[model samples]
Target: MPKCYWLGWSGQFEYLERAKQRLALVVPLTLALIFLLLYLNFRRLTETLIVMLSLPFAMVGGIWLMWFMGFNLSVAVAVGFIALAGVAAETGVIMLIYLDHALEEARTAARESGRSLTRADLHSAIMVGAVERVRPKMMTVVAITAGLMPILWADGTGSEVMQRIAVPMIGGMVSSTLLTLIVIPAVYGSVKGWRMGRGPLREGAPERMAA
Candidate 1:
């Protein structure tokens, strides 16, 4: 019985290896192109850098969870990570857009109130932006997780394969969603600080503009 089980496991591993090799070429090239596009489109070094930095945390968390689950690094897991990159990017884009809108609104409000923009205003803007955006963001994550729940919990008929892919994706999505809301803001703030501290770049800008 053990011999038969070993043979079956070995066969499964061999099949996974072949699938991985085929996927490897496509995945790396696709990721490279996506990143290149992001870099080109954003233009600003600080903004681009923040996006790049925040994007990988999700994969890190997903892979960490996979390891904890004692799963081998299979092609399914690789695919999950690839899918996560897109998801993380989407979340980042949404957060950044909302942040920008919040800042603009705050600046407008400050100007109308005869108050100069200051660091406090910037912080308040971000807080307000986060609060306003939280509902949609949470809903997005919940909806995605809910949609994928069946595959994650599915039994029989390709369940093993589904589990492998779904587990990492779910983990990555959840972790990335939280990090996008929290860590990305912090990173944006830090970058804003460094830029402001350099002086001229921040010249004429409201002192309150945090990020």
Candidate 2:
């Protein structure tokens, strides 16, 4: 046989290598931008951290589903995760919005009555805010799942890539919704309650919380 010659990468592998390099850079940048936006929105490190917690909750399902489906880490899967992060953050924002409103309303009522904010008041506010949001959040998850289901089941050309993208979103949305509805309220209440217990509620306290 003639002497073999070496050549540089070509085809999909070349594209994959490029994607891996870009992904390494992009993921950290994306996370930093997200943190900045969260901080800007809440104006307090505590509340920003609370909202950031949703990312882990979202990741749990995405990773689990990818493993279950026997999918490897590809550019498509990474894209799915990025998309999932966005939706998770959005749901977290919504939760924070409702919680802030309820808490502020309770604070106003307590101030009018000339009494300190009570644990009972916090419980009531959490319940009202969390319960009222269930329908909308479920609807969002359901709609997303429905749209992705087709792509997941398809076996035609490009189905593999599409399915990888859809799987993470579908799985992440379910877990994210549950956590957003349940965990977020509990955490927000705990944080706010801690703040309340530390001292008398200052007039500016509400402004510090995520609204």
Candidate 3:
């Protein structure tokens, strides 16, 4: 017999039902909050949307990993999901910070040279920002994943308890790191392109600014 039977299966089901009901409220409200925050800081809807999309791709990997590990989807895992939301948000914020810094650097350079920052300059800045940001983020994720691996792989000493939390966290962190490093940059680039292609009438403004 399985040592740990699924606890509160009925209650779990009920909790899920309640969660489902609340999701309609939760999602829009959460999005509104994020939008409001982003608007207050950056005032750009397109950038916010791009950053948000990167989160789902990261979550896809996290979910697939948990399923492959034969872990039951439970309240603990739901907690992991909540943790992932914060992780994703943090990753987006870091990426945006790097991007903004890069843009600022490029603008300063352009001003010094008495030339407007071109599309190429902007692209270069974004690339540099992504590269610079990725190293530290990767190191952080690696350290976290490495620290948790033992717990996830432990054979005794109540390893099962640790696995429940550690597995999803490690998985989510890994996936979130990858998505933030790759997908977020791609999304940012695409948004930048779309903004640039809008022509000279709207040139020299950030895409997020346009939104």
Candidate 4:
């Protein structure tokens, strides 16, 4: 009769399991901290919510890239997502600030002209903000994506894991540009209007900013 012995997972596997267990708690704590920080920076729940919305928009691209690259969900992939979230939030912050600046400028101009903020002015301000920042935003996306491209193509030792990490970051950066430029502005415009309890273009116009 042959005796059979059971093989157990290696010590490294045990360690990873433990780390994965802790991650359940760690993830929520980190997300809460991110939300708190956004609230503190913006001082308005509406603005903070708009910035946080970008994180999910970023995930749309990251997940698509992961699927396209045939990477499974693993600790390394999760790490890539965490990194992507941070970058997405930062991009959101920049976009919001630019839009605010443009709106403020429009408000000032309208106040000086002794006229209400018309639809034309609102659209003009939105475009001013979006166009002025396009170069810098594209520069940021290109720089980060370019830096990660080599890793995505890496074939050396441990390249598989690296490529998994880089794929999402690249795709997320690409998609996040759209989120930051289009989605963020749209949401902020809506939120700003809601906060004023009126329509974005016609009611509660730029006159409020001057006061």
Clashing pairs in 1: 117-208, 118-207, 118-208, 119-207, 119-208
lDDT of each: 0.72, 0.86, 0.72, 0.79
Best by TM-score: 2
Ranking by lDDT: 2, 4, 3, 1
lDDT of 1 by residue, 132-203 (tens): 768888888898788777886678888877777877877788788778888887776666556546652232
lDDT of 1: 0.72
| Candidate 1 vs candidate 2, lDDT winner | 2
Q: Scored by Cα lDDT, where does model 2 land?
A: 0.86
TM-score of 2: 0.89
TM-score of each candidate structure, all chains considered together: 0.79, 0.89, 0.75, 0.84
Per-residue lDDT for 1-211 in model 3, tens only? 4887665557568877777677657667775776677556566667667666666776776687789999886555665665666667667877886877777788788889998767888789889989999788988788878887888668887677677767677888878887888888777767766766775213234324222
- Candidate 2: tens digits of C-alpha lDDT, residues 1-211: 4479666779999899999999999998988888898888877788789878779888899899999999999999999999899889878887887887787888799989998888898889889989988988989999999999999889989999999999999989878987999899989988877877897554544443344
For residue 168, model 1's alpha carbon misses the true position, in angstroms, by: 1.0
Q: Which ten residues in a row have the lowest lDDT in candidate 2?
A: 202-211
| Alpha-carbon runs more than 4 Å astray in model 2 | 1-11, 203-211
Worst 10 residues of 3 by lDDT: 201-210
- Report, for all candidates in order, the number of backbone clashes: 5, 0, 0, 0
Backbone clash pairs for candidate 3 read none
- Candidate with the larger TM-score of 1 and 4: 4
